[model samples]
Target chain A: MNNNEKDKKSLIDDYKLHITILFISTISLGIGTINIPLINGFNLVLLPIMYSLFLAVLFYIYKPAKWINKSQSKTCAEILLILISPLIVKLAIASGENIDILFNVGPALLLKELGTVGTVIIGLPIALLLGFKREAIGMTSSICREPQLAVLIDKYGFDSDEVKGFFVVYLIGIVLGTIFISILTNILCYLVPLHPYSYALASGIGSTSMNVAAVSSLIALYPALSDKLLALSGLSNMISVVFSIYVYIFISLPLTEKLYEKFHKYFN
Target chain B: MEIDLSFKMVSEWIGILLIFSVMAAIGNYVGYQYPFVESLIGMFILCLISLVGLIVEKLLPFDNIPAIIYISLIGLFVALPWFPLADLIIYYTSKVDLISLTTVLLAYAGVAMGKDLGSFKKVGLRGIIVTFAVIFGTYLGSAVIAHIALAYTGMI
Candidate 1:
């Protein structure tokens, strides 16, 4: 092919990539627009984020035709990081709007984060009992988001069993975590006696989508406090994102490692 | 050493963000019933803020910090009372719904997940079981603690 033909072909491929993403994204949003009501104003809302994720996964895995190749998929991953910046800005602005309210509840927000250790205390035992060995340390260390994944990778390298464990939890966290937390928050809202505000703070366990899903579920239950709950969730999420790496490196990782050494023999 | 960034690279980044903003504006209009023009304007401002954040990440001498930190700080700076455009920024941006933005980001996240699915299946049933435990532990643990703290503070 001549130079002109090659240039034209590449240009078409570029537009194809953009067009495909835009097409699928718009459809997911369209589907997400539908809000089906469940019993008594508690709507069964599978968020657009959830549907979009599942749609893309299914499209890539099941399609007979190779619409999106490996290189394009890699490009999509790179763009994901850039795309998240605007969302981060939105949450930050939300925090700014409610900074005064959040400041008033500073102690609660600060103290609630300590509960993240529950993952190790509760999850470590279960993971160990499942005969996971050292993998239990990585799996139970944190929620296994990208930040925690980075910690494990930095210390143990990307190919370690720890990272394998990290990927397991990370995959689960993204795919089903939102739906799981949404239902759990709804159930806890009725079963547990905690105030709605506590639920709001609790909903912010670092992952933005899961936090939104959980908080929105709680908001559906208590519409009157929607604004307050959202603000609190945003602040809680920000704190979790900012401080979680330190917590993982200094506290969770070390603690899980020590515990894994002690408990591995018993499980085996 | 000279910065290695090129005009082509920066323009590509900006172009992607603009397309994303357009999708978000449409989503905001359809889902939240927000005005399309207002949402578009709001998202444009947000795109600019995100661009600044990305640039700051490049310019900073230090490494390891996530760009979200800079983005959040910029958002807060513009929204805070001290900023001259705080109210205007807040008003227009609020018109753009948060969930709509997630839809766009996660679409990309989903597309990215295509390659990882093969490895994902290898995780086995045990990994899935432990995953549930870890996720539940974090959410429940945080909620319980926040509950106790709220009770102790008499803020409940």
Candidate 2:
């Protein structure tokens, strides 16, 4: 094969590896979260600690070289631990306790009391971890392939000047995308007499790959919709798997192509 | 609380174990050749056999109650631990789902983490902005289509 073709193939392979890792990490995060014991003498903090340790070990084992590099390793490890923390908290219920028993109080009252904690304990960490991991992977992979990408990134310096622009654009896209999709699904489910919250939970579970946590949260909030929530969770996951593939192919590919072209022109 | 065991319980356990072991053996053998196809084939075979049994029962014009009972018994035999052999079989065969799912998810997670954020950064906000836009747009588009289709089919 020609050098250009070989280079392209290698890039694609690298991208595939990234995609695979993301899928596994997300799934593991979800599964681990679901299995954590929230009650029965177990506290939520342990979940995060365990998850963080797991993440540290995972990164250390998978990319030993990164661990030796100090800064990158720290950032990578922190990002993974943070992203997986919420899921771990959510999974604490997987100790086989009846979730319904924990929320005997009415839905609104329960949500008011637990929602904030859940957000902090389960949501923020996951978001940060996901964002950080995505950034770290993206930056490192680019740096390896094209030193110029690294120089450009370093010049911008993450939050200032040039780098800020990219972050802003990417964040805007992700926020807008997540909101739009979440809202649209919520509305459509509402129109069909299906629970909007269940739909939201399902979408969240599917996209984020946090199955048990999302479903359990919904079940806690709406006990009446437990069966539907479970079914939707499964359905959404299957759909998400397909959607993720399409997203990788249709979105990542075209974007990568354009980036390479632009880099060639400006950096080279 | 101590649990009591009867002859029936022992028999069922033994049966389940036997079935599980056989399934596991077959599964492992196939898995060695094509790991990805393991669970898919197992699920497919189970479904297919069930379907055929149902069809045959219909063709024979069997009494509904008796047929239901027969199927229930068969299902119990397949699922229960009636024999010591059942435990061995189940232990080996029943892990296909877990293995395949874990493998696929792990592979995907690794790759997603490996994405190049520099490109997104290079294009500035535009790249990041577009990524979210496309993801949301696709999701919305699919939801709308699903909603319309469901509405048309009166599934809702």
Candidate 3:
């Protein structure tokens, strides 16, 4: 083969890994949309799980591609977040006609319904009683999502104790939050009656991926309410991104610190 | 063949759409029960949206806002209930399932965690404890308010 043909062959080979992932992921997602009956009687659609396993399998057996590398994967995940962000807006825009869910008490309902405030109020004394360190309290009082990282860095400066504390929690959140948030929100959808749209908005408290997981799971359950769920979730996530950091750092952290001190002296 | 990298990227995107569209068709026959054409159409609109997103980034005075943010806001406006195209656009956009969009993304996230195992281990036991406490606290906090709200609304 000539040099040009040889170069083209090498390029095609390089593209093979990426092409495989895309095709498999699409097929897996398609399958995920269907329910398969198990021998034990429960029908399972395990598409998300299947898709994840596909990636995991590739990571273990195939050559690790750049897109799957830690840093590169971070970029890919962020791109996914940005891509989905618009869909949420579209959902809200469409649903807004039905009830203007974004403006019509959506924020109040999401906060009240999701109980973001209650997480701090009830958990503060308990965390103090558990003897959590001040750093831990700083992390705990906030949902400690990605936006908080920037505010924490700016306020405390990097290398401070609080930064380390935030890093510790942030790491754990990244590892665990991505998965459990979907399951937790799914359980909430089943156990509560606060409206699917409320849960859609509530899911926006963390990263876009988490929001997508929670919203998709709920959408899977309540297909009829899909539009409102999308709109409310999009709006709620934007609010969480814009405002939750300020609320958590300024108000929640100080309040938790004072409570921890009061309890430490008394209990210790 | 000294291939153009940008052209290669575009072809790759098209390849992805082709694969997804084919799978979606199979899904229709296999039991997914959604229209097969919708996935392809939805992706087409997404491509248009992304193109506008890039333009918005170039035109805007401020650089802080990300292109995705602008793209999404524009999407929101386009679908705004009163807009001329709102209803038509929402109908098309709504067809593609969120699960389809998130499934592969989550898969990539899983791969990322796999790739980052070393970083996670560095955090050690303290990270685990802090994470547990944070998760517990947040859930407990939300549960309390949820209970009262449900009670007040008589939803229970």
Candidate 4:
């Protein structure tokens, strides 16, 4: 995976397929932009990202035309980071313009990260209760997004139970996390009555799609607060992107290991 | 040997980013009603910053830091008030909506997922249940804390 041999080969051979994927993505952008108006002036904002994603999936899974092969999909996964760079840049620029938003949010930005501990506090216990072994630590220590998965794989080789556990949650995150978070964000926004800023901060749970979904929902609800919300969410996500690994390694992983020793017995 | 590989890699990245900017600009115009030319220009500048960040990541002795950090910092630096092109950068970039870029990223993500459907189907019910717990715990937990923190800070 580290070597660029496969990447280079795909770049050369599958250049046409890559363009086709981009073409399909453009169509998705058009369809995804549709927003249906519901009662009480609320818009049922259909997720454009969802459509693009599902379309790509259909192209892959449809038997008649196997549009993308394993190598090509692998290539797409590798370039995911590169594709995300522009969005990250956009977020950073948002943060720069609203530097005062950072100051205004103050310790909330730092303290809200503590909420990540909720992953272990809630997820680990349930995972253990469900009879997972050391795997619970891998699954629950963090959200197990790409970066956390990389860290876990480094600590425990890819063959380990921990990694198996990591992949379980990771795949679920990739497949369903965005949809779940978007729905949850909207429900919370409607029911909780919390400030849009808090929702924006919550949206930065260290995964790109999940974070994007959360913030998109917030912006849909609070168009007037779009800039500040984007700024806060971007900064919060940047904090997660930069610091999530250290938190997982130094704080979450170690603490989960300790708690596992004590909690595993009870679950059994 | 490494330098040659990286050079080739940069060109490939440019190709990919070019595809994203051009398509995303069209999407921005169609979906959000942003000006196509302005959005295209904005996306190109973003691609340039990302390229610079990738180069910096390769040049650095330490490998721990991700390119996103450098890319974001470069983005932030140029957007700072005193920077010469801050306004221009801010103006065009504002035309390129964040959500529009996400549609492209996730589309690729979905394509990547298609290859893994066989393995994805094998995940056990326990794992699925716990996946929900992890996602919910992280999001709602953070939201609750942010709620309290915001009230205390009087920002709400």
Residue A96 error, candidate 2, Å: 30
True contacts kept of 1: 0.70
DockQ (C-alpha) of model 3?
A: 0.22
Candidate 2, B50-140: lDDT as tens digits = 3333334434543432222233233324434453443432332243343232223223222222333344345554344334433333333
Question: A81-131, model 2: which lDDT tens digit per residue?
Answer: 212211111112121122233244123211221111221222222223334
What is the C-alpha lDDT profile of model 1 across B1-156, one tens digit per residue? 445455555676688788888889988877778999999999999999989987877678656655566776788778877789988989999999877877676666666767777766766788878988898888888889998998888888
User: Residue A136 in model 2: shift from native, Å?
Assistant: 18
Single out the weakest 10-residue window by summed lDDT for candidate 4 chain A. A37-46
DockQ of each: 0.47, 0.04, 0.22, 0.46
All candidates: interface RMSD: 4.4, 18.4, 7.4, 3.8
Note the chain A TM-score of all models in turn.
Answer: 0.67, 0.32, 0.56, 0.63
Model 4 error, position A113 (Å): 3.9
lDDT of 2: 0.33
Model 1: per-residue Cα lDDT over A111-162, one tens digit each: 8778778999989999988877666777899998755654565456444678
Ranking by DockQ: 1, 4, 3, 2
Query: What ranges in model 4 sit over 4 Å off?
Result: A1-13, A33-44, A128-268, B1-5, B147-156
User: Which prediction has the highest DockQ against the true structure?
Assistant: 1
Q: Which ranking of candidates, highest TM-score first?
A: 1, 4, 3, 2
> Model 4, residue A76: what's the lDDT?
74
Please report the candidate that would top TM-score against the real structure: 1
